[model samples]
Target: MTARVLLLGGTGDALAIARTLGPQHVYSLAGLGRVPADLACVVRVGGFGGAEGLARFLADEAVSLVFDATHPYAARISANAARACLAAQVPYWALRRAPWRAQAGDDWRMVSGWAGVVEAIAPFARPLFTLGREPLEHLNEVPEQQHWTVRCLEAHPGHARARIIDARGPFTAEGERALFTESRIDVVVSKNSGGAATEAKLAVARGMGLPVVMMQRPPLPDAQREFTSAQEVIGALDDYIKRSSNA
Candidate 1:
C-alpha cells in the first residue's frame, strides 16, 4: 500500500507537490476550490475547521505525513495544519514559493497589505488599482470618489468609474509598459502576489517612471520546509523518499 499524506493545498506549490509525490503518496487537497492540474491524487475540498477538526481527520484517515502546501497568503490554514500535525505526531513538511524581488528601475512603493494599499492609494492622484476586482473597491470606494485604472482577468464593474483593462497575464514587460503608457497611469497599485503572472506591472511602472503602491505577502507558519520551483519539488520528493529508505 502507498504511504498516505495529508496535503493542505491551494496554490501552485500544492499542485506541484502533489504531482511530485504521485503514485507513492495519496494527496488530499483541502481547499474550497477546484483542484489544479498538478494535483490528481485523492482530494478533499474546503476547510477542516481549524486545528481540532484537522486533528480528528488525520487520526481517522491514518495520515502518516502532513504537508502544508497552501498559498503563502493562506495563513490560517497553514497554522491549523501545523497544529494538527503536531497534535497527531505526524511529520510535517512545507512547500513554499519564494517571494518576488524588485528589479532595477522598479519604482516600488511597498505597503504591508490590502489595508496599506487602501491608505496609500486613497490619497494618491491618478491611482491605478490592479489588486484584483475584490480589492478594487476597497481603495476606490473611498469618500473622495476617486477614479482608478483597474486591470484584471475579466471586466470588473465593481468600482466607481474604473477604467477597466480586461486582460490576463503571463504578460511580457513590453505589453505591460504599453498598457500603462496608453492609460497615462501616474501611480500603480498592486498586491505582492509573488509570481510572474502579474509582476509585469511593476516593471512597466518602472519603465514609465511611475511608482507602484505594492501590498505585502501574508505570513505563514514555519516548518521543516522545502522551497523551490514546480520541477524542483519533484526531485526533492524523490530524494526524500530515497533517504528515508536508506535510513
Candidate 2:
C-alpha cells in the first residue's frame, strides 16, 4: 500500500511543497479564504470537526505523514493537527516561516495579543490594520474616532469605522509606501505573519518613521519535526517517502 501524506494548506509554502510532492498527497484547506489557490494535488476544503475527526480522517486515508503549513496565527488548527497526528501514530512536521525581527529605524511596539494592539493604537487615530478579518471583531471595543484602514482577502462587514481594502498580499515596498502616504496612516497594526508576501508594509512604515504595533506569533504545538523553508520541508518529506517505500 502507498503511504499517503496529508498537507494542512493555506500558506504559499504549503502550495510549493504540494507541487513538489505531486498528486499523491492530500491538501486540506480551512475554507476561510474567499478564493483559495488552485493546486496540483487533491484538495479537501473545511475543517475535520476537530482533533478526533482529523485523527479519523488520517486513519481512514492511511496517511503516513502530516505536514502543517498553515498560517502562523492558525493556532487551534495547528494544535489539532499535532494532536491528531500523534493519536494516529503518524509523523507530523510544521513548516513555519521565520518571524520578522525589528531593524534600525523601525519604531515597533511588540505586543503579546489582540488587547495589546488595542492599547498600543489607542493614541493613533488613523491606523492601518493588516491583521486580517476574523480578529477585526476585537476592535469593536475601540472608540469610533480611531478609524481603521484594513487590508484583507475578503470584505468584512463588521467595522463601521474601517475602510476595507479587499486585496491579497505579496505587496511591494513602493506600493505600501504609496498606500501609507495616500491614506495618511499614522500607525500600522499587524500580526507577525512572516514572509516577503506581506512584510513590505513594515519596511515602508519604518521608512516613514511610523509606529507599528506588531503582534507576536502564538506558540506552535510541539511537533516531531519543524522546518523553516519549503526546500527543507520537501527534502524531509522525500526522505520520509523513500523510507516508507523501503519499509
Estimate the Cα RMSD of every predicted model relative to the unseen true structure.
Answer: 3.5, 1.8
TM-score of each: 0.78, 0.93
* lDDT by candidate, in order shown: 0.70, 0.85
lDDT of each residue in 1-247, candidate 1, tens digit only: 2356676665655665676565546566554445555445676666777899988988888777787767666778888888998899877788777777888888777888766776776656567776655555554465455666777655655545556767656678888777667766778887766776677777777767888887777777778766656566567667766766566
Question: Runs in model 2 with CA error above 4 Å?
Answer: 34-38, 138-142, 157-160
Residue pairs with backbone atoms closer than 3 Å in model 2 (clashes): none
lDDT of 2 by residue, 132-211 (tens): 87456665665777778888877667467767787887799888988998889999999888888898999989888999
Q: Score candidate 2 by lDDT.
A: 0.85
